[model samples]
Target: MKLRILGCSGGIGGDRRTTSILIDEDILIDCGTGVGNLSVEEMRKLRHVFLTHTHLDHIATLPLLVDTLFNDLHDRPLVIHALEESMEIIKQHIFNWQIWPDFFELPDKSRPSIEFQAMSAGETRELQGRTIEMIPVNHSVPGVGYRIQNDTGSFAFSGDTTTNDTLWEVLNRHDGLDMLVIECAFSNSEKQLSDLAGHYCPETLIADMSKLRHRPRVFITHLKPGEEDQTFQEITEGLRGFDVVRLHSEDHFQL
Candidate 1:
């Protein structure tokens, strides 16, 4: 499987985009502002979107994406896989016509342009050959992480979480993990704020890292734009034994 880091930032600024990850050509983990970087042709290839939550930074471009491909989606609608609660929040707030046209009912209900498939934690779904499993996570809103694996290799993504045992426990249950895309959104100085906002600072993230058993190549993501240097410096200092790398937009991996 091939993974591309479309975006990975706590906030956006010049050249900085919120969280979004493209898996191969057909699947996306989140549809953040980074998704805007894709060409119309690239967007057409997308068939599945697995959302971590209903946060604006994560789902900002979803409405636009569906509207842009309205014509093409009539035949093969885009499938949005997310937690039931997250799906509800999106339906009531974003797609309620007041905000944007409800693509779930657009072009007629029977042949809509988009479909929402409510997913529960611990459940797994296989599309083509990839097995995608949803794992519960601690966040300001109802959220989940994902573990995707195929015959060749496997990987996990900690989707907008703070210090949580569920993520580590689920990952340890598996035999092997090739890569781990986790978040440390703030610096040690902002530990209090990070905790309140349901995000990880370097200190909190380091403490939780002890729970994981596998030694995958860790990629630190979602660092606040201005605090990126300080947060990553602390992570590098604390996680000395682990092979951790700072994840950047456009980074690609083949597993």
Candidate 2:
């Protein structure tokens, strides 16, 4: 399986994009602003989207993506897999006609341009050869992380979470994890804000890292725009034994 990082910043600025990841060419982990970097041809290849939560940064481009591909999606609607709560928020706040046209009922309700498939924690979905398992996590809203595996290897993304046992426990059940894309959204100076916002600072994140038994190639993501360097330096200093790297947009990996 191939993994591509479209965006991995906590906030956007010049060249910075919020969270979004593409698995191979067909599946997307989140529909953040980073998706805008895709060309029309690349967008056409998208078949599935798994949302972590209803945060604006994580789902900002979903509505625009559907609208841009409306003509192409008539026959094969974009399938969105997310928690029921997340979907409900999208329906009420984002896709609502007042905000944007509800594509779920657009192009006629009989065959819409997009579809939502609500999934629960612990549930797994198989698309082609990849298996995606949703694991619950603590966040400001209902949230989840995903564990995706194919025959060759496995990787997990800790969507948007703070210190939590569920994410570590669920990943431990798997045989092995080749890579881990996790968020450390703030620097130690903003540790209080990080906790209130349901995000991770280096100290809190390193504390939670102790719960995981596997030592995968760790890629730190979602660092706040200006504080990226400091936060990453702290994470690297604390997570000494593990192979840790700061994730950047457009970086790709093969597993």
Candidate 3:
């Protein structure tokens, strides 16, 4: 399995893009503004998109992606997978004709350009050659993290979550996890704001991470633009025995 960092920031501006990861070539973990960096040729190659939540930063580029590649998707269709609530938000708020031309209805309603498939947490769905499972996580909205595995190895992404029990337990339940991509959105100094926003700071993340049974190479992602320096510094000092690295846009990993 190959993973590419499309965008991995808490907010957008400059070169910072919100969270979006391309798995192999067919699967996308999230569809943020970072997705715009991909050309029409690259967007055409995408078949499946898995969203973390309904937040604009995470799902912002999805509607545009459909509109940009609508005419070219002759036999190819994009499947947007997430919880039912997330699906509803996209349909009602984003593609409801007011905000954007409902591309799913365009080129004809009989054969839509996009499809929404709702997934329940803990439900394992097969995509390409791997098994992808959604796990519930603590967030402001109905959010979920995912664990994806092929025959070679498995990788888990904790999408926009704060300290919680279910996330730690599910990760420990899985025997061998190659990489763990978790978020530390703010610094330890901003613990109050972090908690209110339902994201993790360094201290909170460290406390929760201590419960994990496996020691995978932990990569920190989703730091706010201005807070990047301090948050990365804190994560480096906090997580010992785990190879910690802050994710950058061009980084790639194969498992």
Candidate 4:
């Protein structure tokens, strides 16, 4: 399995992008602003997108991608799987006719380019040669992260979570997790805010990492832009026993 980090920043600026990751060439973990970096051909090849939450930084580019690639769909709908609440937010706030033309209904409602499939936590959805499961995480909204495995390799991503037990329990149950793409959105100094927002700071994140039975090559993601260096430093310094590193756009890992 090839994991491509499309974007891994919490906020955007020049050279900084919001969170998104592409699994192989067919599945996208989130369609943040980073999706805009993909070439037209890459855009056309997308078949499945697993959303983390309803946050704009996580799913902002999905609507735009569907709109831009509308004509190229060729009756192929972009299947987006996420928590039912996440889908509801997209439909009500993003894909609503006025906010953006509902790609799920444009050209033709029956043959639209985007389709939202509600996935509840703990549900495993298999497609092609892969198994992708949605699992709960501690986030402000009703959000779930994804753990995907193919015959060859496995990877799990903790989507915008703070600290949680079910995530670790689920990972232990799967037992094949090779890489963990989790988020640490704030520096250790901003622990209060991080907790308030239901995101991980280095301190909280380190504690959470202790729950894992196996030490996967942990790739840290979703740090707010300006805080990158400090957050990275804290995470590296604080997490002395783990293999954690910040992720960036276009970085690829072949597992």
Candidate 5:
């Protein structure tokens, strides 16, 4: 499986995009602003979108993507897999008629351009030759992280989380965890804010990393815009004996 980092920033500016990861050509882990860069043909190739939560930064481009593909999607609706709570919030706030035409009910409710399939924590779904598992995570809103595995290798994504044991526990259960795309959204100086906001500062993230039994190549993501350097520096200084690297747009990992 090829995992492409379309965006991995907490906020966007210049070359930075939000948090969207494209798994090969068919699946998108999150539909953040980075998806906006895809061409019309690339957008049409999307078949599935898995969301972590309803946060704007994580789902900002979903509505637009549906709109862009509305006509083309009549025959085959875009499948959205997300937590029930996250799906509810998206229906109420995002895809609602007020915010954006509820694409689920547009054209025709019987066969709309989009579909929502609720996925619970610990549930695993296999598509093609890959397995996508949802694991609960600590966040302000109902959130989850995903662990995807194929014949070649496995990778885990911590959507947006703070210090949480569930994610590590689940990851530890599986061997051959090749990569872990975890988030460190704040600097060490903003440790308090990071805790309250359900995000990880460098210190907290490194502390939690100790819980992981497997030694996957750690890729840090979702660093807050202006504080990226400070957060990366702190992780480098404090995160000992781990293969950690900061993620950026256009970075591709072949697992």
Candidate 6:
């Protein structure tokens, strides 16, 4: 399967975009501001969007995406998949008319332009030979990480999670894990803030990473805009034994 990094930064500014990943051409792992980088032609090609949580950084461009490609989606409405709680937040706060016109009601409910599908952790869905599984992760809000695999290999993304056993436990179940895109949002100096915000500083991330049995090429993502170098340097110093790299927007991988 082909994966494209639309954005990987924790916050936006400059060339950094929030957090969004495009799987192949149709599936989007998250709908962050990074999505704006895609052309209208590219947006129209998207059919399914799987959200990690209800955070604005993750779902900021979703409404805009629907609005921009509304007329082109005649074959079927775009499907937005998320955990029930996350879906509730999107329904009540985001898609609500007050914030934005409900695409589910656009043109009418019978022939709506968008649909919400609820998914549970551990559930796996296969689309055109690619396997997508949702694994629960500990975060400030209801969120999940995604594990995508095919016949060749597999990769997992830890969507905005901190120190959590469930994520590691699920990953250990797999025989082969090629890559791991995890988040370290702050530097060691911000350890207290990181803990309070349900994020990971290098200290905590390295500690939790020790629980993993498989050794995948780890790519650090979601670093704070200004603290990128400092946070990554800490990760580099701490995770000495692992194959680690920093994730950047537009990076592509075939696994």
User: Regarding lDDT, does 3 or 5 come out ahead?
Assistant: 5
Q: Each candidate's lDDT (Cα)?
A: 0.94, 0.95, 0.89, 0.88, 0.93, 0.92
Model 2 C-alpha RMSD vs. true structure (Å) is 0.6
TM-scores for every predicted model: 0.99, 0.99, 0.97, 0.97, 0.99, 0.98
Per model, state how many residue pairs clash: 0, 0, 0, 0, 0, 0
Which lDDT value does model 4 have at 82? 85
Number of clashes in model 2? 0
lDDT of 5 by residue, 1-255 (tens): 998899999998899999999998999999999998789999999999999998999999999999999999898999999999899899999888889999998789998999989999999989899899999999999999999999999999999999999999999988769999999999989889999999999888988999999998999999998999989999999988888889999998898
Off by over 4 Å in 5: none
Give the runs in model 4 whose Cα sits over 4 Å from its true position: none
* Global lDDT of model 2: 0.95
Candidate 2 per-residue C-alpha lDDT over 1-255 given as tens digits, one digit per residue, 9 for 90 to 100: 999999999999999999999999999999999999899999999999999999999999999999999999999999999999999999999988998999999898999999999999999999989999999999989999999999999999999999999999999999899999999999999999999999999999999999998989999999998999999999998876689999999999999
Candidate 4 residue 182 C-alpha distance from true site, Å: 0.9
Cα error, residue 242 of model 1, in Å, equals 0.7
Return the lDDT, model 3, position 192: 97
Better model by TM-score: candidate 3 vs candidate 5: 5
Q: Considering summed lDDT, which 10 consecutive residues are worst modelled in model 1?
A: 235-244
Tens digits of lDDT, candidate 3, 197-226? 999999999999899989988989999999
* Runs off by more than 4 Å, candidate 6: none
- Residue-level error in angstroms, candidate 4, position 243: 1.5
